[model samples]
Target: MTEDLTGKRALVTGAASGIGAATARWLAAHGVTALVLVDLDGPGLAALDMPCEVLPFPGDVTDEALWDRIEAEAGPLDYAVINAGIAGGAPIATMTLDEWRATLSVNLDGAFLALRCATRLVRDHGAMVLTASVSGLKAEPGTAAYGASKAGLMQLGRVAAKELAPRGVRVNCIAPGGVDTPIWDQTPFFQEMIAQAGGDRAAAMAALSGAATPLARFATADQIAAQIGFLLSDAAGTITGTSLVSDGGYLL
Candidate 1:
């Protein structure tokens, strides 16, 4: 929609579907020429047919080595979207160590690894955005692991922004509330939450939408992706080290 990234090189992780996919498509539509998409979903990324130049690199964002390989594969990057994340729901007492670690590894550590590598290749006039959640700043008893990781991600963005600002590399984050995404299918906690809450699954998911939202609806993946696209562009040149909420005003 916005022709701000016409000559930029960008990378988007967790880009198979949902917000990541929306972001990649939007960037391409906006004229970003060099687009590097990273995901474990090789089939999905390979299947995408878009207008921009895309290099789909399949790997785990949590793996430190993946960043190195992406660099060797995609040349210099102008923007990086750290969009991979995990959700682990349960009382803290009953949560498994593996579950807890996986949440932090992908949401927090994965973001760090991406930004660390991106900062190296990002032109002096570059930017990076990480995907956080409304849970990052809200209170959710059952989502201890997920919330903690997301909260830490906001802090990571702040620190990275401070560390990278001097170099003209802007670092920021986007926190969305509940958006329609396949991530729900990947998590076991949704079913448990539905059962625990004693409500219809469709009703529950709809209830999370902007029923009381100031904006009157849940955010579409394209909506969040648009914000990400803006941040990566020169439009957000003065924006850095901040967690921009795209939750349709659930926090309000």
Candidate 2:
């Protein structure tokens, strides 16, 4: 069932593409009045066409100044989807300090800033969803930084939920496995992985899915967006501090 969000406002981070963009569209489809979309992609943010009013903020999510601007400009938010992240892959022994910092800066610090701002600005009874990763729940060799950051994000959501409960704000986490998104194309590690499958991204994805994910396929961006939508809606009013795994049984 599509929830009616006619008068509500939402803020979505990493809004230029992938799951973030998909979630913005989903909120608009459900009748959200306005959206505050944040991302580092200027052209991508400017190009987005949505049904609701969009206030695009193009900047680094880790910047406290950006959050200050967002809070000032966005007014009262009814929902927040803290979904901005970057993937980093390397064995801990070989991973540079810079690489590890870069991953955690976005995946963890960014989430913390976004959630802190959201908890402050969201109206009472508001809700939020954080994009975590299956990597956090179950680790593999090359996921040192990414896995640690996501695991931290999951725990952050739980703590945020507890602290915000008194104010009627609910916070939840979504730990997605492999989703067919442009992120794969952008990450160097994934590019190499894709190359190993003879430059066929789909084939590589399928091979990985077959080997790891019980469902044998990648989750679509829209699929994850739908789950975010549900968590933000009234139907999930009682849910908080829960990490909803949408990984096609990858962890299983």
Q: Pick the candidate with the highest TM-score.
A: 2
Q: Please give the distance, in angstroms, between residue 88's alpha carbon in candidate 2 and its true position after superposition.
A: 0.6
TM-score of candidate 2 on Cα atoms, chains taken together: 0.97
- Provide the lDDT at 181 for model 1: 78
Model 1 / residue 97 / CA error / Å? 1.2
lDDT of 1 by residue, 1-252 (tens): 445667888989998888999999988888889889988788989988879888988888888888888877788888889898766687888989988888888888888888788878887868899999989899877788899889999998899899888889998899998777777756676666567658576665665563647776777789899989888877788999998888777888
Task: Summarize candidate 2's per-residue lDDT along 147-174 as a digit string, tens digits.
Answer: 9999999999999999999989999999
Clashing pairs in 1: none
Off by over 4 Å in 2: none
Q: What Cα-based lDDT does every candidate model obtain?
A: 0.84, 0.92
